[model samples]
Target: MDQYSVPAGPAAGEFRDRSSKFVAALYHVQDEAAALDAVAEQARIHNRCNHHCYAYRLGPGPDRWRANDDGEPSGTAGKPILGQIDKAGLSDILIVVSRYFGGTKLGTSGLINAYREAARLALEEVTVTQQLLLTGVRLAFGYALMTPVMSALSQLGLEMADQAFGERAEVLLELPESTASATVRELQAAIAGVYVEEVGDDFEVEGLTVLVTPTGD
Candidate 1:
């Protein structure tokens, strides 16, 4: 995919129903590791909360997603949060709803509604941006081709994520998947058609941070 939607940055919102408080937090995450970190950070800040339910959709597509109710009823908290994310047409994001039990049980449907609404509240406040679907590629070429390859990459506005120079030059790059073939063709033509190996299908792209909800609000 050349482009897809993602949150611009971290967002927060709260909803109260029948005294129960649901604080929804949404973050722009590049991978599952980042998602976990975001959740851990929330847990630290809101220690002793009733529950920390979360759902994440990572990458340009929907296949890389997971939901966890975190002790909430099955399909109650996490699924609803995920549903709201899908409804908003967002990806590469993690949305967590922390519950502070308000001395009254919300039951199944009420809990789902509260979590879903809280997530939507955060989504509404955050900015959305379209980003490229990145793909990792590794290229190794003879030392003689270094200058030309570097020149070509620079001219194409591509940056190497990692680079190694020895008897041979090896560089790892992340480029838009939609343009990978064309990029490879251009680079190969520049260096006289050398082999370029695709590293894997781990798409992680940089994201800009925008304030969705102010801290301590």
Candidate 2:
């Protein structure tokens, strides 16, 4: 399956009505147990609520996951929230909706609408992108050629994660999986013809860290 992007950490939002309160929950988790734990924790924190319904997807595994409506109707709260996650094509995500009664009891349909809308609204506040396999390349260049090289790299759509200036300038770059090889080749051809230096290893880049892994390890 495709590795789509979801939020990396927990996010939350609240919606209120004259007689009901809805809290939306979203979190990124590595496994079903973790996802359930997060939901349980959130439910515990908001235990005073009338209902705590949850949905989650844990990627493809024995841990693909499940959802529960707590005490609400069987399909009202949990299923609709799960539908929102599936519609977004997002996995490794968990969402829980907590409702507090304000002297009025919303029927099953109303509960479903409130939970679904709350989940949707919370997702709208998040920025989701495709989670690409990122590769990092370090380039060292003399002062005279630095600007041109940097500009070329930028135009190639490389993410400049870090830079350090000294006798020779060093730059850390991130390239997506589809373009990593081509970008590396372009960089070598562009610099080898003009400079006398070595280009560093091609490795996976995550956030500010560059990681090197063995072929089977």
Candidate 3:
């Protein structure tokens, strides 16, 4: 897919029932690693919480998702949170709900409702934005081709993720997937002595600490 909806930034929501407190945290994640990092971060922040239930969906695939009840009833916490994420039609997102038991038992139905409502509330506070899918490329060339390669990148409005100047110069790039092949062909045809190869699917804008919404196509 060219683009998909993701949270604009971090958001939080709270729910209280029978004196029990549920805190939900929402984050934009790029992959499973990022999702797990978010989960760990939440756990650390709520270290005293009774349980830290979480759910995450990555990419556009149906199978790229996970849910964890984290001590609540098997289906009570994690499933409800995931349901809210699916209902929102979002990807590259994670939701973690930390529960502080109030000494009163909410039972199965009550627990489910609380988690669902907490997740929904957190999502409601989020501003959704489109995340552009990009393909990664690595370029290898002699020092003589550096000037032309940089010029080509500038002309094509492409961003370089990294550059190394060793015996042979190397540059990393992020390109829109739809035009990645054409871009490679154009670069090779225009700049001889340069080798271009696709590295992977994931890409990040250089110097960006947070997920960015690329403007235009």
Give the runs in model 3 whose Cα sits over 4 Å from its true position: 143-172, 190-217
Q: How far is candidate 2 from the true structure (C-alpha RMSD, Å)?
A: 8.2
lDDT of 3: 0.82
Judged by lDDT, which candidate is best?
3
Per-residue CA lDDT of candidate 3, range 85-168, in tens? 999999889999999889999999999999999999999999999877776677777777677777777766778887878887
- Poorest 10 consecutive residues of model 3 by lDDT? 204-213
Q: Supply the TM-score for candidate 2.
A: 0.58
Residue 61 CA displacement from its true place in model 3, Å = 2.7
Alpha-carbon lDDT, every model: 0.79, 0.70, 0.82
RMSD of each: 9.9, 8.2, 7.9
Count of clashes in candidate 3: 0
Q: Which stretches of model 1 miss by more than 4 angstroms?
A: 135-175, 186-217
Q: TM-scores for all candidates?
A: 0.71, 0.58, 0.71
| Tens digits of lDDT, candidate 1, 91-202 | 8999988888889888999988999999999999999998765666677767666677778788778898788777766787777766765676666554543334431233
